[model samples]
Target: MTEAAFIDIDWAGRPVRIEYQWIARDRAAAPLIVFLHEGLGSVAMWKDFPQRLCIATGCRGLVYSRPGYGRSTPRAAEEAWGLDFMHRQAQEVLPALLEALGIDATRDKPWLLGHSDGASIALLYAASYPQRIAGAIVLAPHILVEDLSVSSIEKVRAAYLETDLRQRLARHHDDPDSAFWGWNDIWLKPAFRHWSIEAEISAIRCPLLAVQGLDDEYGTLAQIHGIARRAAQTELFELADCGHSPHRDQPERLITAITAFIQQQPHGDKP
Candidate 1:
């Protein structure tokens, strides 16, 4: 396992310790792709995907576990996330991490590769800070909440309460409850049904690739389709025989598609 490093940043009037690792850091001048994990994911959960993708794309990779996940600062027991959680991560947490690490977004304009909730954050970041990102490739991104998504979340919640889900997540998160509930409780909230980023994503000015799994139980094809409709820069890809986690489900194909997409960038590296 790659040794992870920690950086502390103050967010929401509290100090947060973020755990991160650099892949192929020796590629000094290569363009960077920052890897954002899924809601329940941590740098540990991402495993070798970041390294594999970076190798194929010849891009340096930054993989980090957000607050409340992995070995980072866990969420307070009483803390509950709001509808704007994703937005807060995009606007505050991400930028803070970059600044603390001395990564000047104005110069590097790194690309973002995010999964699930992280994918939504990537889209929000690209939209909110157009000049700070060169492009984004989102896997199983959710633009708006669907009944299917709520239903799946409900099931996962039950499994967390009834099954070994907690024990399983223990391998990834320092406190699985902190990772699971923070994501679950918010998504299942009644008012959360109205959560949507359709308008905000229209402001995205960077290269965008929004991908969805045809068989994703948490969402539908509408997710990427909707992004393409709202964001002119977005390109949509729907993979067959895949579920929510494409990086795990269809890594080779996903990697191939992603490499092709990034290589298409004017200054992106080629295979």
Candidate 2:
């Protein structure tokens, strides 16, 4: 893997330094795959999966760490993300980053590959800007708040407080508290229990591939099922014996499915 480069973008009236890297940049004309990391994830957290996937499909890949996660900006100590946090990320931060990088999504129409909260963001982006996305492949995305999801987050909070979870996250984030508490506090808020994107996602017209792990502890299969129900262009993949992080637990299968799905799309721009 290559070291990340930094770029600053104006987001929410503040300059945010984004950490990003381009994998297989030599394939300039090939389809672009933009990677969105999970809620607690960062650029380093993705390891080499994006590179491997890009190589497999012979496409260029862009991977980045969201603000407050990797070497990017950290959240203010008193800051607490709202229920609309993901929406802002999809609608504001992402577009700003793309513009800063001179990526005209309107023309390039990159494919989005996302996991967990990142997947949710991808869905939101594709829905909001249908013309900008070639397609999307999401893994273990949360479209709505479920008791199971809340419970799992609750457990993770305990682990963060008591176990080595903080240490583990520190390896990925410069300020682990920024990543953990930002995600943790929001999901655990009582008002967030009603948070749902099922209706908003109905606007997505681009092709979609929603993947989930059967044994995922964070959420149930209904997440992807609900997506497919809402978007007629959606294809579903349920992997058995896998957990919340399919990219980590089942990378080969996930990559294969994603490659096939993208390559099979109309005007998929096969290399």
Best by lDDT: 1
Q: lDDT by residue for model 2 over 83-148, one digit each (tens)?
A: 999999999999999999999999988999999999999999999999999999998999999999
Q: Count the clashes in each prediction.
A: 0, 0
lDDT of 1 by residue, 65-123 (tens): 99999999999999999999999999999999999998999998899999999999999
True-structure lDDT of candidate 1: 0.93
Cα RMSD to the true fold for all candidates: 1.1, 0.9
Off by over 4 Å in 2: none
